[model samples]
Each structure stands twice: as C-alpha cells, then as structure tokens.
Target: MPLRQTIARYFSDHAETNDSHTDPLLQTHYYKITADKGVTILESLFRNDPLYDIHASSSDRGEISATITERKKAFIVATVTMVKPLQTAIDFSVTTESFLRFDLGFSHKVIQRLYAHTDKELPLVKNIEQQPAHR
Candidate 1:
C-alpha cells in the first residue's frame, strides 16, 4: 500500500487502543533513534521542537542516529543534529504517531518531504548500512 493509505489504516485500527489521552485526531507516534551516548541530548532537543519543519541543508555540520525500542509496542526513534557553521547545533526528532490524526494525503506528503530531506544526510550515516526504513 502507499504510505498514505497505510498510515490511514494504521490510525483507524490502532489509535484508540494506545491510550485515552491520545486524541484520535492528534495522536502522534514518537521516533527516537540515537547514538550510544547522544540519546539524552537528542531527546531533550527534539522534545523542544517536535513539529518544527527543519531542513537538512540548514545546518553546516551535524549527526544522524537512530535506535529502535519497544515501549508498549515497537517504535523507531530518529535524532537529527543540524549544526550551523561555528554555532551550536539545532537538534530535533520527528515522530510518527500510531494514531492517524491528520489527512492521509497531507501526512503522506509531509513524510515524503522529510524523507527527501533526510536522504541528503546519507554521507552522515557512514558506519552503519542505511536501511530503507520509514515510520
């Protein structure tokens, strides 16, 4: 299935079960993959800008890392650090909520954009083989 359809089906089937606190219209899944020691810093920074539309080209230097963990269920976490030339890095995480809250078309488009933005950082993930993973 296309990402859009898959996302919608996912939300329809799973949203309410996650929690009563999770709004079916605003349910969000969190992804947090990080380097061995960098998870803490990444988590802190990402929580600050969960929905920020950051671009990869905006940074001069940065790191990309991820980790997969099971919290009630399986989820992947992606950490991005966009560093400006000689400046402190702007780090954040993008989350894919289990529940579908937004329009499927919009959700798919946004994710596609983020996917392209992330692929630009391929040079950054040198040690590990890049996986064809998506939320």
Candidate 2:
C-alpha cells in the first residue's frame, strides 16, 4: 500500500467509513452588519480566495456554498442571518473529503482565517445613539 494510505489506515478512527467522510465541521459567528451586506461580503471573500470555488449562492436567502481544494478537498457552506438591525449571525460548515476520520483541526483553522479576514474587511461604525427609555 502507499505511504499515505498506510498512515491513514493507522491513524484513522474508523476504517469502515467510506472514502469520503460525510461529517461536517460547524462554527457560528456574530458580526455587526446587516444580513444583506454580510452575504455580499462573504460571497466576495469566498470568490476572491483562489482556494475556493463558489458552487451555489442565494443572496435573498443569505446563503453561500462552495468547494475548497487546497490541502484537501472540502465543501463549505455559509449562512447569514439578521438578529437585529445592526447584528448579524454567520454560520459555516466545512466537510472535508478524506479517508481519515479527523482533519487535524483544519476546519477550525479555516474558520478562524475566514473570521479574521471578514472582521478586517468590514467597515467600522463611528457613531451610535442609545435607545430612549420606554415611556
């Protein structure tokens, strides 16, 4: 057997699983932006990354799904939801294609990088007014 296959067989949690693992690595993040803008920004981010290829997107639904092939073949899905006027939530799911059961924290690293990039790219608000007390 090949070196990679031998190592994978030794390190893998379960060998019975199929070649491509179906489990998803998931993470959710909150940001200060409207859902619409968040969708646009995320889409742009994914498209700009050479490692990723956007396969499906719905601006109206604030969802984007893409394939990433760098160190490993993976699928990424992101969803943006509006929690308040100035608050939004983004969720990411990464599924890697590998014989090994674990990705060695690769998915987490991807999420961290994405969050850092998004945070840096988002515009900062300069002013904010406190809400008035209810009468």
Candidate 3:
C-alpha cells in the first residue's frame, strides 16, 4: 500500500473523542507534532498561520492530541489529523536527504524556500498539556 493510503486507512479505523479541556476532538492512537519548521512552511504556502494542534496516533495505536496556542490568541488554530508509522520516520531521514540532493542538483529552490519559512514558524509551537498536573 502507498504511504498516503495507509495513513488514511489508519485514521478511518480510529475512534474520535472530544477533549473539553483543550476543545478538540481527540482521536485515539495518534502522535501530535507541532514543529516550528512544519508550521512556518504550512503558513507560507497555505496562507494560513499554523497553531500546530495535531491529533494523531502512534504506531502502537495509542490515541493522542496536540494544541499549539497562538501568541495573540489563547487558542489553537492549526489542527492536523493523521497517523504515521514508525517506519516512515526512518525512511524519511534517507528519502528526504535524497530528495534534497536531487533538488539542489537541479537548482529547484522551492524546497529551500519552504524550509526557510517553516524555520520561522517553528519557535511558536509548543506541546499541549495532556495530563492533569498535581498541585
């Protein structure tokens, strides 16, 4: 199966639950990633500033969610829903490097530009509180 197809299937089979505390539907077995690089890249390309609130699942099928609060607004803006396999992370390291090499050789500046913007937005992302802290 293709990577995108597999990701879609994982989300389809999962159950979604509402999290009143964070005000987002929590899907079981997901990993939330709010990297600054990803945020900046999305905003520049999509014209949408990302808050990096992603609800995702891990390879083990454990449910999780994320919320990235905006500096001005005390709420999340970017909500992502998907599932990524553990193996993909490893594959990405090599594949991404290769892709970058190819792009650089061909003088394709798009990737460089995208990554630069993503770097700007990355510092704003922070993980959402998942557990109740004891006083």
lDDT of each: 0.33, 0.67, 0.29
**Clash pairs for candidate 1:** 28-97, 29-96, 29-97, 31-77, 32-77, 33-66, 33-67, 33-77, 33-78, 34-66
Q: Each model's TM-score?
A: 0.26, 0.69, 0.21
Please write out the lDDT profile of model 1 over residues 1-135, one tens digit for every residue.
Answer: 467646664453222211122223222222233332233444443344444422322122334333222232212223333223221212223343444443333433333343344334322332112246568
Better of 2 and 3 by TM-score: 2
Instruction: Name the regions of candidate 1 deviating beyond 4 angstroms.
Output: 2-101, 124-135
Weakest 10 consecutive residues of candidate 1 by summed lDDT = 13-22
Best by lDDT: 2
| Model 1 vs. true fold: TM | 0.26
**Model 3, range 33-135, lDDT digits (tens) per residue?**
4333233344444344364344442433222233333431111123233324221100000011222222221111222333345435433222234456779
Between which residue pairs do clashes occur in model 3?
28-63, 29-57, 29-62, 29-63, 30-56, 30-57, 31-56, 31-57, 36-122, 41-118
Q: Is candidate 1 or candidate 2 better by TM-score?
A: 2
Candidate 2 residues 1-135, lDDT tens each? 467755553454322211133222222455678999999998889888899999999988888988786877777777788777877777676666778666655655566677678769775332223236569
* C-alpha RMSD between model 1 and the true structure: 13.9
Best by TM-score: 2
Ranking by lDDT: 2, 1, 3
